[model samples]
Target: MTSEPAERAGVPRRSLLLGAAAGAGAVALGAGGAIAPPAQAAAPFVKGADISWMPQMEAKGYYWNNSSGVRQDLFTILKGYGITAVSLRTWVNPSSDPGNGHCSIEETAQMAQRAKNAGMQVLIGFHFGDTWNSVGVQNPPAAWAGMSYSQMLQAMYDYVYHSCNVIKYYGVTPAWVKIGNETNSGICKPTGSISKPAQMTGLLNAAYEMSKQVFPSTPVLVHLAQPQNLAGVQNFLDAYRSNGGKWDITGLSSYAQGGNVPTVLANMQTIQSGYGKPVMQVEYGGPVGKPTQVRDSLRAFVTGVRGFGGLGTFFWEPEGYPSFNGYNSSAWDESSRRPTAAMDGFLNV
Candidate 1:
């Protein structure tokens, strides 16, 4: 569940995977001639989906209405469908509420435990903002509303360490933890803006360091918005790594409405090879306007990602939209339902 894909205009697109695979079994036999195999294929890899943005706040009216029995039943449903991971977000502080209600530390821990108990890996999203954070906007939480530059940096470090500590102590440590959500603009606000890449890198490095210190075995993920921005992606990675940050995974937030599938796949391959780390499509989904269109886009996207040698991909919120007005339609809505076409693509490949 990434903020709408309204900010991904200038990214490049290339069909590296589909095109590269076309020449796999072809051999040059004569001048301007080649022999190709009658059959060609690509090996299958892991297929995982992300389930972040499930309503955690009861006041938001999107609470997991399912009882313990129902909750377990739903997990069984997902597992049977080949879903193997669950992602949840954590808010430092929410605007409507001071404490992290649905997106609190404790709530996330419980969700992680539930997913783990059901035999699914957990991916934790740590939004270093009060609410939404994306490429165009990445604001500090209301609690840190007036802190100075230095103070904010220290707070960011402390927050990461404290959060990791809690997760570790509860024995629900995430298999992968993102330092910040869709941090294309940067995180923790007035100080960590992308305008100052070095400053942003320093802040991210601090968080990464703290995360490692608290949970040495967990992988620290560095996420960016829109998979098509080649320059932005490379710039972010170069700055982040140069500033002493250590990342085990390169995560991307992509949406079908943002651009063409070929462009997204091409950019993903570039990043994956450039960083030498497994790439994860941390967030992706098509709007519910047309079910078939959405399903087809998802299928192509998933297949393209795997073809590019991606580690795994996760769908944003296959459950339902998080209503800002406090009325969640259901634990999972029809618009976000698991389309058979999309599910087949994931399960088969």
Candidate 2:
């Protein structure tokens, strides 16, 4: 995610990865960004959105409408658009800030249950902080500040374990569990930064193991932002693997790439092939007004990734219309209060 606190806060997670360069020790990407799709077919692809802001939006009296202009529930509208799943983010103990906070475990579980009731699969994103964690900032929770590495590891484990159990208690089983959101720089701040590979992997392992213990069948994802930065992603994953990091899926964020689908696809191909993991586009979005362009880009990406056997993509906050929280990349229409053609990208894929 990007570094802007306001923008990141508005999305209930990280901002779109923008302008960030590769980290130190990064490898140079191979020449020629374009790559042919893999031979394997990707079936049961997940077409989803990160609607973590729905509860807060609903609380603020925001609503959605169908094409005919009739008010409908958010999930109903999303289902009509062919969204098969929803991604929800969680924080350690978020504040009540209207734009920035309110992703506590209880709220996350409630969202999960709602998604399940809607017959949509759930992706649980653990931010591992009181607010947001992305490539720009991975601040450890306030309660975990100044904690020794070992202490924080236990804290991370307990938090993930308890959170998973609570979600299960609410009768919702997650389809995917991300150890951290956009953890290109690693999670939980100084102690878990990618610069310190050992500490990073240690914390990741704790989160991974605990998540598996709870949902042994769910895929645990290791997410990194900015797939366009092939070197940065490769460096982080190299470190992760060298340090014995474990994950079932390699999640990526493809945003603001200036329509360079070839580059993004190349990186996804490399990661899926190199790490031998199922690569997924966990977050993506285009500006709100360019519905046609956004729709085309989304369609291209979904088609390209699926062609290469990459996991499905999730549009980041497509519901953020009228520029809610200063977010301008949502798929909703400002005046009509209905979904634009942007979401058509996910259809017929």
**Candidate with maximal TM-score:** 2
User: Where does model 1 exceed 4 Å of error?
Assistant: 1-46, 53-72, 95-101, 257-259, 321-342
Per residue, candidate 2 scores C-alpha lDDT tens digits across 1-349 of: 1113323333122111210121111111111211112321334787889999999988887888877788998889889878889999999888998678998887888789989998999999999999978889889999999999978876776677677777777788898898898888888878998989999998887777666656766778999988889999999999999997877789999974345978888889998999988888999899887888888889988988888888889999988755458878888886888788888988887
Q: State model 2's lDDT.
A: 0.80
Taking all chains together, the TM-score of candidate 2 against the true structure is: 0.87
Worst 10 residues of 2 by lDDT: 18-27
TM-score of each: 0.75, 0.87
Kindly report which residue stretches of model 2 are placed more than 4 angstroms away from their true locations once superposed: 1-43, 256-258
Model 1 Cα lDDT, one tens digit per residue, 205-251: 66766665555556678898877788887877877767655566788
